[model samples]
Target chain A: MEYQDPEDFIRDDSFLLYCSGKAPEATARWEQWLADNPGRRQDVMQARELVLYIQAELTDVAAASATFRQRLSPVSDLPAPVFPLWKKMLGVAAGLLLLAGSFGIWRYISTPDWLEVSTPLGAVKKVALPDGTQMWLNGGTTVKYIRKFRQSRQVVLEEGEVFFNVVHRADVPFEVRLPGGLQVQDIGTAFSVKSRQQISDELLLVQEGKVLLKKNEQHIQTLEKNEGISIEKGTMKTTAVKASPVSTSGWLTGTVALDNRSFSELGIALENTFQKRVIINGEQLKNRSITITFSRQDNLQQLLETLKLVYQITYEISGEQVIIK
Target chain B: MNNLSPEMDVLWERIRHDDAGAVVILYEKHYTDLLTYGIQLSKDLDYSKDLINDIFLHLWEKRRQLKPVANTRAYLFACLRRKFYQQTGNKTQVQYLEDELLQSISAQSIPSQEEMLIAIQHTTEIRQRVQQALSKLTGRQQQLIRMRYYDQLNYEQMEAATGIAVKTIYNTIYNAMKVLSAELKGVPVITLLLFYFEKR
Candidate 1:
C-alpha cells in the first residue's frame, strides 16, 4: 500500500492511528515505511501535520487515554478477577434497594454517617484511623468507620483484607466487624483480617499483641502474637504463621507469606495484587493448595515463571486472564 | 470517519465474555476518535471528557448485555453522540454538527510552506515573522504551539511546568498545529516550532 498523495496518507486509518500514537504496530510500521521510503517523508510529514492539527486540541489524547485508564480502575474490573465486578454490582444493587425502600428518610439523610475508604485492585493504601490506629488496606478492600469518632473505635471491614496497627487504649475497646456476623475486638494489638466469599472462609492473623475473635458478641477465640486462626464454616484450625512481625507493616515493604493456601485463595491474591485472573485447566489443579511468598514488587509474569518451574505447568496470558495448565 | 482495521467482532466477543483486557484495547483504539467527536459536539473539553469516561465505565458493566452490532465505531459514536446530546439537553445534532463543520472549513486558509521557508533565514527577521504570525493565533493556539516545540521536554516535565495535563496538551497542540497548517502549509511542524522557540 503505497500512498501517492498526503491526502491518501491522511485517509489511511493506520497512518492516523500511528499519528494518534494509539496503535503500537502502526507506529512501528510507519517508522519502518518512513525509513524505507525517504522520498515520502515530505508527504508523510504533511499528513502527520494534517492529522495532528485536524483534530486541534485533540492532539493531547495520550493524557485523555490515561485519564480513561484511571476511570477503568476500582470499578470497571480492569483485570482478571477484574475481580469482584459482580459482587460490587450486588452491593450497589442492595444499596439502591435500601435507598428506594427508605426513599422518604433517605432524602434528609443523603450521606451516610460512616466514612468509607476503598483501595482499588493492584494497589495498597495506608490509612490513619481516628483512634490513632494505622491501617494498611489491601487491594479491593473497603473499610468503613463512623465519621465522627467519640468512644468506641469500631470499623467494618466490608470486603477484602486489612492489616492493622491498633493504637491500644485499654480504656476504649477497638472492634472490627466483618460479614457472617463475625467480630474482632482488640485489646490494643496489631493484626490482619482477611475474608472472601469465593473461599467461604475468614482468616485472622496476629502480628503482635492479642485479638479476641467473636461471632455475634459470642466469644470464639483469642489469638496472640504470631498466632493465626482460619475459620471455615463450623470447623476451625489454629496455626503459627510463617511470617515475621516486620512483614506485617506493609505488603510492599515486607514479604507476603501465604501458608497452606488453596488455589482459590491464590487466585484471589493474584487477581487483587495484579488485577489478572487466574484460570486453571483442571478441577484438581484449581483446588490444589500451595504455600508461596512474594512481595508487592513481584509481577504476574514472574509468578507465572515460578509456577512453570515448580509445578511444571505451562501458561498463557491473554489480556487480563492468566490460564494455567 | 475512519474505518478501523482491527477486527471489532473479535474484541466485541471477548469483552462480552468478561475479557477485561479486550475492553482496554478497545478503549485505547477509539479514545481519540471519541474525544474528537465528543469535543466537537459539546464544544466543552471537560464535559466531553467526563462524559467519555462515564460511557466507557458503563460499557464495561454492560459489556455482556450489549447486543451484537455490525459496525462497532458507529455503535460507539451513536452511544457518545446520544449521551452528548442528552446531557447537553439538545437534540439538534445534525444541524449543530453541520454548522461547526462549515465554520471550520471556511476558516481553512493555506499558505505555501516552500515560499515561507525560502526567504526567512535570518534569526531576527524569523523571530519578528514568527511573533507576527503567532500574534494572529488565539492565546490557546499560541500556548499549544509552545507545547509542540518543547519536544525535548518529556510529557511529565511539560505537564508539571505548564500546570497543564499531559492528556490535553498533545491534543490542543495538534489543533494549534492545524491552525499553523493554514499559515505555513506543508512545512514540517518541527521547523515552525524552531522558528517559534528562537523568538523566545
Candidate 2:
C-alpha cells in the first residue's frame, strides 16, 4: 500500500530475496514503491537493474550444440550391414554386452606406459628412470621421459627440484635445463639441481657425477661429486665447500637435512616442498639459520616446532596463509 | 521452411535404416544451445564443448541396434541429460539403474510448457535454458501458461496433465508471467543472443 523509502526497501533482505527469487507481485510492489519515491529511485533502480541484467542473459543453446556437433565427422553414407557369424549366433543381446564390455576394458588399460610421474603439491617421488638413472623427484616436481631410454636421454622439468643419479653413459651425456639459460651436463656421475622461479638460476650440488655447469656457452664451473655450485645469469661459482649426498638428497627420503643453509634458502625449500603460502613477517626469521633434520611430510605444526627448537623461532598458521615469525 | 523440419524427417528415415544421420542432425541443430546451457552450469566453455563432443561421438558409435523409438527426440533428450550429469561428475549410470529400481513413477499426466521446451531444446541451447527456467516451477504453472498461450489446451486437459486445482494453475502462471516480465526488462533486441549458443 504505502511507499517505503526505496533505499531502505532495497536493503531489506526480504525485499531483495523476493526480487532475487523472482516473485512477480513482490516485484510489482517494489516497482510501485520506487515510482512513488522518485527522490531515491535511482539507487533502488540500480539494484533492480543489476538483477535484471543477469536474468536477461539467457544461455545460448543452439550455437553450443552446433559447436559440439561440428567436432564430429560429417555423416556420410552408412556402411552396408555385415552379417558376422558370431553376431548371428550370439543374437543382438549377447553381442551388445560383449561389445560394451570389451570397449570398457580397452579404455581402462590404455594409459601410456611412459613413466611420466608427477608428485602432488608438497609431495616427492623417488623414481628410477629408463636408463638406470635414479631420480629423486622433489615436491611439486614433474619429469617426462619415455619408458624406454633411447639415444641421448632427454627429460623436460616443468617446475620444482630434482636430484639426478644419471647412469654413466659417456656417449649419451645427460643434460638438465634450468629456468634461465643455465644447463648442467653430466658427463658421468651424480648431481642435484635445485631451482625455483624466484631464485636466480639453479643451485647445483654434485654428489658423485662430474657436472659441467654451462650458462650460455661459457663453462661456469666443472663440479666434481661432493662439490656444490650456484649458477645464475652469466655467473657461476663453487660454494665455500661441498655438501654431503645424504644432506643434499635427504628430501627424497622425507627429511630435509640442512648444513649451514640460510633461513631464506631453507624457507624457499620448505615452501616448494609444502606448496603452502608462507609469509616471513620478521627480518630475524629471514636471517636466522640453524641445522635441523625437518621431515618433509611433517605438517606445518611439526615443522614450526622443529624451527622453534632449532632457532627459538615461533610461527602462526591461519587457514592457507602461514606466518613464520 | 526451417532447416529443422526437413532435416528432422531425413534423420528419422536414416535412423530407420540403422544409419547415424539422426546423430548428425541432432548435432547440427542443437550443439550450440546445449553448449551454452552446459556453460552456465560448468562456467568453462572449453570443458563444456569437449563434454558435449564426447557425448555426441558416443551416441554416434552406439546408434545402431538402439531400441526402436516412438519418439526419437525424447530418447535423445534423456540421453543428453544423463550425459550432462555424467560430465558434471555427478550421477552415474548405476544411479539411473537404482532410480529404475525405485518403482516406475509419474502419473499419466498431460505435459507442460517446460516439457515442451525440454523436448524442443535438446536439439539446441537457447531453447534449453528457456525451458530449464520454466521447469524450475511446479508442472501446474507450466501447464497453465502453455494451455493459455501456446496450444490453447483447455483447462480440463491442463488440469489432467498438471494434477493441480485449475484455479491454482491460473495463479501459478500469472505469477510466472510477472516474474519473467521483471527479468526481461531493458534487454535490448540485438542483445537477445538467440543464435549465440551454437557458436561454441
Candidate 3:
C-alpha cells in the first residue's frame, strides 16, 4: 500500500475494516504497516478514531435495538398460523354470523343508543331528525345524536360546521356539543355551530332563538338572536360578536362574508368552503385583517387570486394545502 | 454494502425453511439499522418503529415463499423507502437532506436568540458541537459523506451515479472526514454516539 497522509489512511477500506474490528487480516496488515513506520502511529490512530467516529455517528445500534426488541417482543411471541385458508375463512364467517345475530337481538331490545350523520368535503347535506328538526351540514361536518331523540335532543358536533333549525319543544331542550367540552343548549330556537380542526375557536351563532353556553358544567353565556360567541380551548373567556344573518346562514344561500377578519381567520373560512387546508405562512400576514365577500360557487383559484391582489400577498397551492406567503 | 454475509446467508436459508430461531436472528441483526433509517426517512420515531415492525411481521408471514435476496439490508432499505413515500406522498429531495444537515450546523454556529434561551434551559452542547463540525464540510462533501456512510453506497456505485471519478470521490470523503475529525476532536465519543442514536 502506498500510504501517504492521514487522508490516505482515512480513505483506505482496509484501514476502516481494521478500525471497525471486522477484519483480522486487515488489522494485522495495518499493525505491520504502522510498525514499519513508527512516526505514522499518531496519524494512524487519528484515522482510526475518525473512522470509528463516522460509523458511530451513522447510528446508535444498541439503543435502537433495545427499543426495537421491546416493540418486537410481543409480536414474536404470537403463535404461528396452523389453520388452512378455507378453515380460516369458515371460522371468520361463523364469527361474523354469530356477531350479526347477537347485534340484531341487541338492536331489537335496545333503542339503538346513537345515530351519526356526516358530510364529506365540498359537500353540504340537509338532514331531518326523527323529531322534524332540520339540520344543514356544511362541508366535512359530523353530527352524532342519541337514537332516543324525543326524550333528550342532544347532538355532538364532531367537526366542521352545522346549522340547526330545532322544532319548538318546550318540554325537551336541544343541546349541541362542541369540541373542548363546550355545549350549546338551545331554548326552542335555531342556531349554527362551526368547529373545524384547523381553527382554534369554536363558534356558536344564534339565528332565531336563545341558547345557553356551558363549559365543564359551568354556565358561560346565554346567547340570543343575532348574537354569537367564540370559545377557545382551555380558556374561560368567550368573545362575543354581533352576528349578521349572512354570517350564520349565508352558506346555505351560496354566500360568504368576512368583516375585517385576520388572514388566519380567512384561511379557516376558505378551508371550510373549499375543503382544502389553508396555511398562512408569514406571521405578519397571518394577523393582517381583511374584509371580503365571495360566493360558495367561486373557485379557490379565483378567491386566492383576489386575495393576492387585495392583500398584496402570494400563495402557492401544493396538493391539499394552500400556502399563503 | 454487498449483500448478506455467509453467516447471514445461512440464517436466511434456515428462515426460509420455517426456522423461528433463524427469523429471530435475522430480525435482531437488521432491526436497529432499519429503525434508524426509517426514522430518518419518515421524521416520526413511533411511525418508523411501527413500519419496521410491520415489515418484519410481513417477512415472517411470507417467509416460506420469500425469494433469496443478495443484499438483505439494501432490500429492507428499498422496502422502507417505498412504504414511506407511499404514506407521506413526499418526493424525497436528496438535496434537502444535505441542506437540513448544513442548516443544523449553521444554526448551531450562530445560535438564534431563541436557541440561546433554549440552551440555557437544556444541555445540548454535544449536539451543537457535532452539528457545527458537520457544517464545516461543503455541501457536496456532506452529500458524499452521507451517501457513503448513511446510505452505505460503495465508492464505485457513488462514482457511477455522480459521474465523479472513484479516486476523486475517495479524496473528497477523506478530506471531509479529516475536517469533521478535527472540528469534533475534543468531543466525547460517547456523547457523539448518544446524540446520533437519540436523533434516529
Q: Please say which candidate is ahead in DockQ: 1 or 2.
A: 1
DockQ of each: 0.08, 0.06, 0.05
> Sorted on TM-score, highest at the top, how do the candidates line up?
1, 3, 2
TM-score of each: 0.41, 0.37, 0.39
Candidate 2 lDDT at B107 equals: 26
Which ranges in model 3 have alpha carbons more than 4 Å from their true place? A1-111, A260-262, A271-279, A282-288, A299-302, A317-321, B1-200
Model 2, B4-101: lDDT tens digits are 45546567567556565466666656555554444333333334445567766766645565555445444444455455554443332122122332
Q: Docking quality tier of candidate 3?
A: incorrect
Highest TM-score, which number? 1
In the order shown, the chain A TM-scores of the predictions are 0.61, 0.54, 0.60
Docking class of predicted structure 1: incorrect
Tens-digit lDDT track for model 1 on B94-143? Answer: 22233433333311233233322322222223334334545567787565
Of 2 and 3, the candidate ranking higher by TM-score: 3
lDDT of 2 by residue, A1-325 (tens): 2324232333343354333322223444555765777675444544443322222232234444443343332222223333544223323333343345532101111123333445655656555454545676776565666544556676556566787766555567777777666778887665677766544445678766477877675777787767886554346434544566555666655556666655665766677557677777666666565575555457868778877786777788888767777
Which runs in model 1 stand beyond 4 Å of their true positions?
A1-111, A234-243, A246-254, B1-200
lDDT of 3 by residue, A54-136 (tens): 55345445544444443343334444544466334433443454455532101111124766666666666665565556677
| Cα lDDT listed for each candidate | 0.60, 0.52, 0.63
By lDDT, highest first, what's the ranking?
3, 1, 2
How many clashes does each candidate structure show, in the order listed? 14, 33, 0
